[model samples]
Target: MCVPTNAQEADTPTDTPTEAATPTTGYFDDAGNWVPPARDAAPDTDNCPQATWPPEPVSTSERAASTPDALPVTYDGPCGVSAAEGYEVPDDVLASAWLVADLDSGDVVAMKDPHGRYRPASIIKVLLALTVIDELPLDQKVAVSAESAGQEGSAAGIGEGGDYTVEDLLYGLLLSSGNDCAHALAQALGGDEMTLLKINEMAKTLGMTDTRATSYSGLDSAGMSTSAWDMGLAYRAAFDNPTFADMVDTESYEFPGFGDLPSFELWNDNKLYLNDPDGIGGKTGYTDDANHTFVGAVNHEGRRLVAVVLDTTINNDHRAWEQAQMLLHEAYGVSGSVAKLAPANTDEPETTTAAPSPAAGDDAGQEAGTAWNRWWSYAIVAGVLALAVLVTVLSLASTKKRRQRR
Candidate 1:
């Protein structure tokens, strides 16, 4: 062999080399195969250009134009799609109003004409109880007067001259929806009319602008109206009174003295009493004028919800319970489960007071004139009677003058 160059000269290859320099190694390529350079000592050119490996990203607007967006995420509670579908209410049910609020979060889940004013029947007792609890001592004994005992409808039979603790009356008022209890409490607190004044004042102080009470019993009257919003406020205030809430939720209660007379066992008139999930208590009202009214509360999971249904032809307590359940299920993922509401016994006659009768003078005025030609006949009869009386008096005077002349 030709004489080999010195070892140092052989190791340091000449610039005019027989083989090219290799490319530096880098991370693996997209195919996961190590790519070698075409020239042993040069950069690679067979693979994709290094600059073009990461292509420019497409814009969001372009992607959206090519494909539709995905469906919206599911939401629970009164704000969900199910609530938007609306609950089924009877055709005759006029103006069903409701509001479902989370007590802890103060979030209003559902509202249907929340500010619309409608009659509140025995539901007024809730506020009355609040007033009593706030103003008087619970254990204080109030002597039942004729005014309280003689109250017309649904009496607790706390007879005149009898005595009961305020607590007892509160139970009667809430559990039984007793008109007498309301009257007794009103009279105990303030005399006639003043009770209503106090209720109105208290409502105002509570910021219930649309709430008004003309009677403690919630009887039909002019200017007696409350909105769902105002009722919610009232419910919130009432719930603060543990005694008031406990009394309303109680299924039955017996007074101390009334065992011999008709037992004071009271059944809640609110049909939603047991049926509503987490239902605390409620009240109901009905009349020829105010068809049906309800104000009640349900604990929406850990949240407190108050619902008010007014002017419904159907049993509003049931309808309100259903609507509330739907709202809770749809908006907050609460299960719309319900317990059976206790039914009233058919044997027990539904007790209601007759509407107050008009005064005798008012009745007489209404019946004064008949269409059978009676008006002229009555006028003629009156004129003849007057003439007869005048002639009799003149004849007596003439006899007196003759006697004097003689």
Candidate 2:
């Protein structure tokens, strides 16, 4: 399929399509909005590879390869309804891969190309946040280094010679989507190399086998990648940590000024979190290669639902968050499933809490910290393990845990 060469960021919805002298490449929707070609077509495989079985693992660990056919057969299609026979998926989703799943029940309510590997952009920050949330103390102070202060995109206003706390940086990281904050936080977690290792380990613990973090802030890296399915798993697991959950929900934070810099307030960049009443929280990201990526959660009728969209282009009809809102709306009443999200892995060695002090040439092969944070163990890991065990027992008891098309 020929993709549109000229794609513009999404604009607010309108009753009529815009007229122009030059013709556009895509067809308008029922609302008369000019949907872009990228929204309606599968991504060019030359740019985005399909999620094949036994994909190249980033780590050399001996774990089993992810099941083929893209986990659940229903989600194997490039374009079709996986929710149910008559369910209508929104036509303007603009994503190459997307998923809507129940965060609490783990049921994959709706999806398309759920396991397609694509760049995650800044949504990968959620993984970094989870990795260090238990490892670093909120009050611990950091001296902003020149590297962090000079980060390329979307700075949180940190300056060299400035002193900030983990809490302050957390605000910048989530609310502002600060790349500078990510770098500073990575340094605190050991260093870039050690932090990436820990972040990938966290991905494994959450059963996100399709994800591999090569950058601290989700920037495009040679081998960095994630999928809609893996993103859903990571987001769902992130909510288990109260600190992460609260940070994403916070709308505004007052970051303290240091040295010659003046104190300034940072606003949350997640439109879903800012707009929807039921919106619990979410993260948004974009890069040239990633286009637009998002992972967000909403509470509807007491059920928490999470949506992930990867490799999307914004159109006049919807932005990444708007597409996510559409998915969540369609999922509220969905009863069928392609497959339940895999439960979090509890056997991950404790590597973040008290790992050996940051040393030279650190890699994944290094030994994990001997001392595990009791709070994280009891609060996060223990709870996740119990849930995993419960899911296993239930699955063993009932063969029909996952729904099939009639």
Candidate 3:
């Protein structure tokens, strides 16, 4: 099947029609506006200015407020795949973009903002993990690179010259959202260029057409992005691999230090693991640009429901989990499943900010333009400082203890 392609940083829902629907052709401009892909028409992807640290992701609020008639995107809220038939999506589900699907049958149970391309933060590590797992053996030993060890953000406290097995790195990558671990794996597997080639290849094989593999760690890079729908596709492809399942599902791991080095402890961030009995495991993501994003799964009886929630904001870290929980309950209650999401053109003007309630008539969308908001940036900065301090303190203490022992 030829999946419709859009030539933009963000997805502009296309009319695939199997040569059935009217063909819509365009790419997104630098302003996140859709334009034809013609060289004269579309913004040059090569010359597009890369986003800097104090970055800003495209906002849903601004898009909602735009003139609807000129663009391919007519709607600003959920793709309209809601509770119907036996499924029951509550009226007050809180998420910028979300989806719950049955991986067993490749069926979409329900979805919200399915195609909204948002920042993934560290969650893209799942794709990197999935790719490496397929190529490297669990016991394969790898030497950490300076570039990898010096990476910013969360880490597994791997030393500059640490040598570890693929299995150990996987534990760190999934359990701790370790940017360093992700980089080490990338260096071991291949450099950035080759690693991304593999990841994009994996995405293509899984039919995640909306995803762009711009970074190994899902750190907000120049053009890296994914949607809830795309994440649903990524995780579905990943969960099928037993290695992927085992790692994310692990609550805690101890990496035995090499020789006299200090051991590292990694705790899983998939909070659902502890609170929900049916929760299998998942990855958590956060960045000033991406806000709080998540890709999680739950298994009940014989069915597995994978839920992808993106951009829950910094203030409400639990919103994504709660939203996923609601989706699972409603999915279990729903009788049958959609063969897949048959989302119509998202061209409509119904999205508006209103108090979330049980009222189905209320458009299920929140005001969401300011993604890289000031508060979120501050939070990210604080988190980074705290993590840096943690790594530094641990390293200093370990060095002192080693000197004493010698």
TM-score of each: 0.56, 0.69, 0.64
Q: What does candidate 1's lDDT look like per residue over 133-209, in tens digits?
A: 98999999887776777665455557665658898888877766667778888888876588888888777776665
What is the Cα-based TM-score of model 1?
0.56
Per-candidate Cα RMSD to the true structure, in Å, reads: 35.1, 18.9, 28.6
What tens-digit string does per-residue lDDT give for candidate 3 at 1-406? 2222211111322221122222233334343333221121112112212111112443332222322121123223334445447776654454566788887766777666566566677778878888888899999988987787777767777776676889998898888787878888888777888999998887767655456767778765555556776788778878888999988888789875655787866778677765788888988776545656777788888788888877553222234567667677778866564436322222321122212333434343222323436669889999999999999999999999999999
**Which model is ahead, 1 or 2, in terms of TM-score?**
2
Decoy 3 TM-score against native: 0.64
lDDT of each: 0.54, 0.71, 0.64
lDDT of 1: 0.54
Candidate 1, 21: how far from true, in Å?
A: 99
Highest-scoring model, TM-score: 2
